[model samples]
Target: MPEQFGILTMGDAMITLNPATTGPLRFVANFERKVGGAELNFAIGCARLDLRSKWISRLGKDEFGRVIYNFAKGEGVDMTDVAYVEGHPTSLNIKEIREDGSGKTFYYRYHSPVLTMEPEDITEEMFKDIHIVHLTGVFMAIDRKNLDIVHRVLSIAKEKGILVSFDPNIRLKLWSIEDARAAYHDVFPYVDILLTGRDEIKSIIGTDDDKELADFAQRYSISQLVIKDGGEGSALYIDGQWVRKEAFSVTPVDTVGAGDGFDAGYLYSYLHEFEPAKRLEFANAVGALVTTVSGDNEGLPLLEEVLSFVNQEEVVER
Candidate 1:
C-alpha cells in the first residue's frame, strides 16, 4: 500500500456554542457546545479522508480545552504538538444561525491561548512528515505576531520541498479588510497553492477582472490558484489554463465550515494526482455536503461519502 500523505496546520481551536433556535440570540436560551477552528477543521477534514494530519497550537488547561483536544484526537488528527497553557483561556464563540443558513459568530475570547504560541515555536522538525503546510488568514489575524509564525512555517516547508496551501479566510470580526489584504500579500509569494474565495481575492487584489487575477497569480508565481465562489462553484488556474466547475446542489443547514471542507477535498485530490476537473468536482461535493449538516468539522464527509456523492450515487452520512 502507498504511504498516506501528511499535512500540518496551526491555529486556535474554540469551544463554539450553538443556539437551540435560529434568529436572535437575545431570545435563544439553550446552546450546544462544539469545537471549531479554521486550521483544526481543515486538519479534521483531511484526517476523515485518511490523510495523516498534524496540528500545532496552544489550548488552555481547562475543560473546554480538553474537549477540543480530545475531539480532534478522536477524529484521528495528530495532537502531539498542542500544549496546555497555564493562564491563557481557550477561545469561545456563540453562533447565531439565520433561517437562510447564514450566521454571525460572537467571540468571547479574552487572552487567547494561541497568543502564547511564538514564531520561534515553529521549526523545520515540525514539517518532517508533512506533504503540505496549510495556513489560514484567520490565525494570522488573531494576532499580528502569528504572521511571523506563518512565515516560519512557510520557510521551513519551502526548504523541505513540501507544498504550501493557503486560505485567505477573511474575517472582518477579527481584522479589517485592509489589514487582511496587506498581511496575505506578504505571504502570497511563498504560497504554492492558494485556495481562496473569489470575492476575497478580488477584495485583496482590488480587481475582479479574470485577466488581472491571472496576472496577480503570475506575479506571485503561484502554481495552483483556485477561486472558490459559494454556491456558484469554483474555478482553477494552472499551467496557464483555466478550469471551471459548477457547484453541487444542496440546501445548507449551516455554511460555516464549507470552505475548510472544500480545501481538504481539493488537497486530498491534488495529493492523489486527480485530474483538475475531478478535483474541482470532488471539492464542490465536499463543500455542498458540509452544508447539509451543522457544526464545524462534523459536516466534513469521509472519503467514501465524498466518492458516493461525486460519483452521482446516493449520498449517505456515516
Candidate 2:
C-alpha cells in the first residue's frame, strides 16, 4: 500500500489587495486583505481537498501574524511547525486590479520574520514520515539564510526518500534574472517533480515552446516536468512520455493564484495515482476555475466541484 499523503510546504504568507471597484488609483484605493503566497496557496488548496498539509515558517507577533495563524488553523492546516517571533512584522503584498481583471502586485517582505528562518528550524526528524515536500523559487529570492533553509529541508527530504515537488514560481521583481537562473539550476538537481510556466522558462532558458521546456527539465534529471501555458493549455512529461491538454474556457476575473491552484490540483491528482494525461487535464481545469474569481484561492474548486466541472456536458462555460 502507498504511504498516507501529507505535504510539508515552506514559504512566506502575505496579505493581498483587491480593488473595491473598477477604477484608477486615487489618493487612496479600496483594498481587502487576503492570503497571498505561492506555498500558502498550495497548502490551502490541499486543505480544501481534505489533505494532511502543514505550513512551516516564522510569523511576527503582530496583528497580521495573528490573522494568518488563526486563518490557517481555521482552514484546518497543521500549525505545529509555525514559529512566532517577538519583534518582527508579517510580510505583506499589495495587488492592483483593473476593470478587465488584469493586475500588478508589489511585495514588502524585506526583513520579514519568515526570512529569518535558520537551518536548525528544519530537522531530519521532520521528514521521517511525510509523503511529499513542496517548495518554490520565491523562497530562494527572500534572503541567503532562507535559501539555506530551503536547501537544508530539500536535502533532508531527499535523504528520507520523500517525494520532492518544486515550482519555479519565478518573480522577476524579487531578484535579478542572474540570481534566478543560478538558484534554479542549483535546486533543479534535487527536484523530483518540476512545475514551471512557459513564460518563466522562456525568460530563463530562452524558450517558449513546450517540447524545449520539457526537454530542459529532463536534462536536469527531473523525471516529471510540467509546463503551464495559460489559456493555450499545459504540457506534461512523465516517465519518458509527453502529453498536452487544453484548459477550460472561462472569463478571467483575476489571474493571480491560478498557477498555484494548478500546482495544488496537479499534486492532488498525482498523489491519488491519476494518469499523466488526466493529471494535466485536472490541473488545467483547476487553474482556469481560479481565474473566474477576483481573489487568490477564493475561486479554487473543491474536489467534487472540479470533478463536476470536468464531467459536465459543456466544455466551455460562458
Candidate 3:
C-alpha cells in the first residue's frame, strides 16, 4: 500500500544526557541514545495516529544511521524513501535534560547525509501515493541548496495537487532571522496550512498579535493558520474566523517534541475532515501527550489513546 502522507526532512539523531543535578552538559554523566529530528518526530506521531506516513531523507550508511532507521521503522513509519549514502554518517545532536524540565541542545549536523540532500534526491515515485507533503522551515535554513530543494518539492507537490502543510520550526543557530523571513516569502504561496508556535510566529514574522498573524496568513493565501500558544492554548484561523481552544495540562518529562506532536495531531484531524476547532483540540492533546515521556517521539499516542485522553477516560489495564 502507498503511504498517504509524506514528510520531507532531515534527521538529527540525539544522544541525550540526563541531568542528575540541573546544570551544564559537563556535569551530566549518564546518557540515553534516541532518534530525534523535527520531521522524523512528526512522522512518528502521524504513524501512531494510523496515518500511513512516510519519511523522506538521506540516511548515512553507518550504525548511527541504522539506529535512526530502525527506531523510526519500529515506530511504524515508512522508511522506504530514505537513501543510504556510504561515505557520510548521519547527523548527531547532543541534548541536555535538566531537572526543571528546561533543556539545551547542540547539533553536529554539518556535512551529514541529510544535510547534503540534492534536488534529485526527491522523485515522482516518492509522491505517487502521498496525499499531503509536510514540511518545516528548519530544512530551509540549512543552506541555499536545501532551500532550492524545498522549492522544487513544493512545485512537484503543487503539480500533483497534493496538500502542502508547513511548520516554521525555526532554528536560530541554522540561519539568521533575516534569512528565515526571506525563505518564508518564497515558500508561503505553496502552503495550504501553516502551523506555528506563537513565539516562532513572532520570530519569523516579527509578530505575535492575532490581527497581524491573520493578515500575514491572508496575504500568503494560506487557507488555514494554526497558532500554538504554549500553556495558554491554541487558536485556529480559517475563513477569516478565529477559533480558540485551550491546552491540555500535563507534567512534562521532556518537552522537546511537543510541537511536532501537535502537527501530527492536527494533520490526523485534517485527514479526517474534522472541524477547525476540533482539530485544534486534538492537536493540543497530542502535544500534551508527547511531553509525558522522555524521548522526542516516545509519547505520541495512537488514535484510541488520543480519543481516550480527549474524553478523560481512565485506563484499567487487564
C-alpha lDDT values of all predictions: 0.91, 0.82, 0.81
lDDT by residue (1-318, candidate 3, tens digit) is 633554444334433333455667888776667777888888888888888888888778888888888888898888887877887767778776567767777887777686667888788787877778989987777666788788889999999999899998888898888888888889999999999988888888887888998899999999999998878889998999899999898887767789999998998888878888899999999888888877767787787888888889963121
Model 2 RMSD in Å is: 2.7
Q: Count the backbone clashes (under 3 Å) in each candidate.
A: 0, 0, 0
Candidate with maximal TM-score: 1
Tens digits of lDDT, candidate 1, 31-86:
99999999999999999989999999999999999999999999999999999998
Q: How would you encode candidate 2's per-residue C-alpha lDDT over 1-318 as one tens digit per residue? A: 645578889988877665676656563357777877788888887887667888898888888888888888888778888988977788888766567756566788867888668898897766655788999988888885677888899899888889899998887788898888988888888999988888887888888766676688678888888889999999988777778898888889778789988988899889999999899988988898889886777876777777778887443442
TM-scores of the candidates in the order shown: 0.96, 0.92, 0.92
Write down the lDDT that model 2 would get: 0.82
The TM-score, computed over Cα atoms with residue i paired to residue i, of candidate 2 is: 0.92
- Candidate 3: where are CA atoms >4 Å away? 1-23, 97-102, 315-318
lDDT of 3 at 271: 80
Residue 151 CA error for candidate 1 (Å)? 1.0
